[model samples]
Target: MDKAIIVFSRKGLFQKTLSAFDIRSREHARKLWPLVSFDESRQMVTWVSPSFENGRLRRRAHFRVLPTQTSYNPKQHFDNQENHRWNTVKESTEHRLAKELITAEISRRLNYGLGMPWRFKDKDVSNFPFLGNLLLGADRVVRLCCTKI
Candidate 1:
């Protein structure tokens, strides 16, 4: 069957949201990890990976903040095989028409529930407006260069 990695998330500053929850502990997937359509019409990422053209790789990549709890996908965000699928799904998500996206795109998840204008603190980055934790309509996405990268 063809695959279409349709990430289940709301629209935001990001051109696209993650398609499926990251595979965490093989029991639960981290929320918002891009979904795998598994349909040939779309895309699929196997435990292993397939190669692509170099130019294709460079063109599809766009920078955005990531979550710190990478334990969800302990496989490493840049895992050779998985990273390709991750990026493909992400690019497709962002380019699709906004009418198709969901409310959660610009909102946040909270202990009480999920909603908008969230105040999330990334201990990873000691600053306000952290990535994923955005002050939408506020103009800038908050990002802290705390990662040694």
Candidate 2:
């Protein structure tokens, strides 16, 4: 099975309409990422996964974006599509750590509560360090930061 790792989320002013996934080999120094964008004429979303050679990464015309059959609805957005995509992807023990890392980070941002019914597999997934109260406090800080900007 091919392994992929999400190095980090690349969000900024320049790439406003795209989300990138940086994948790298944990055993080697190789790096790769998928840059997702919308193709208006094709009416389909594009996923461009790049391969690197000569240990250098660059924007070149040799790469191609493959079109998947999946069509995203603008009204509903990615909430439903993400759930379906997650279920369709083949799960393996190799990527368990990467999955847990992303899950924990999202759970942290959402402030997962013990009372919530959401579960990972058959068990309820709860956030450690109990940040519910902290999130409330952080909301004030976030507002202050936003207002300053």
Candidate 3:
């Protein structure tokens, strides 16, 4: 099981065992999970959120990414390297969930009355770096590219 999924499930955000569709969806959440850090001691995972204070909105988080030891064994070193290379290559594949997260984040902020002027539009796309191509269908899809907020 993915470490992030386990942590999120512990937080009641997901089930311990994910279905096929859930597994696919959770994979996207995994990448973003690295942006935050989990506290095993407190059983809390913290990440940045947009907060409004003093008539302004800003990013805030309660915790930072924790460092972990990387174990190395001489016998498995070669195999580990090969596996890491393959995983790196696989990571280049398209990320649909990331785009969806950005759309949801946009909607959440909009609900809080932010980004009112920069509604999803070609002219305003430059301003919102988190957003990408907008796809409209029975289910509205907003393409997004991941970047540091």
Q: What's the TM-score of every candidate structure?
A: 0.16, 0.21, 0.17
**lDDT-best of 1 and 3:** 3
Please give the lDDT score at residue 1 for candidate 3.
Answer: 12
Which digits, one per residue and each the tens of the lDDT, describe model 3 over residues 1-149?
Answer: 11322334454533343222233333444543422222233222323333668977664323333445232233365578777777765534345566567778766655555543324545554654344333321233345454322
What residue pairs are clashing in model 3? Answer: none
1-149 per-residue lDDT for model 1 (tens digits) = 12223344355322242322232332333343443433332232322122248645423222222334222232453485665765555534344444234323433233234435445677777867544533433432232222222
Q: Model 2 reaches what TM-score against the true structure?
A: 0.21
TM-score ranking of the models: 2, 3, 1
Worst 10 residues of 1 by lDDT: 140-149
Q: In model 3, state the lDDT of residue 46.
A: 26
Ranking by lDDT, best first?
3, 2, 1
The sequence of per-residue lDDT tens digits that candidate 2 reaches over residues 51-139 is 56887766422223335635334446556776677676646665666666755664667564322233234235644333234334332
Between 2 and 3, whose lDDT is larger? Answer: 3
Candidate 2: lDDT of 16? 35
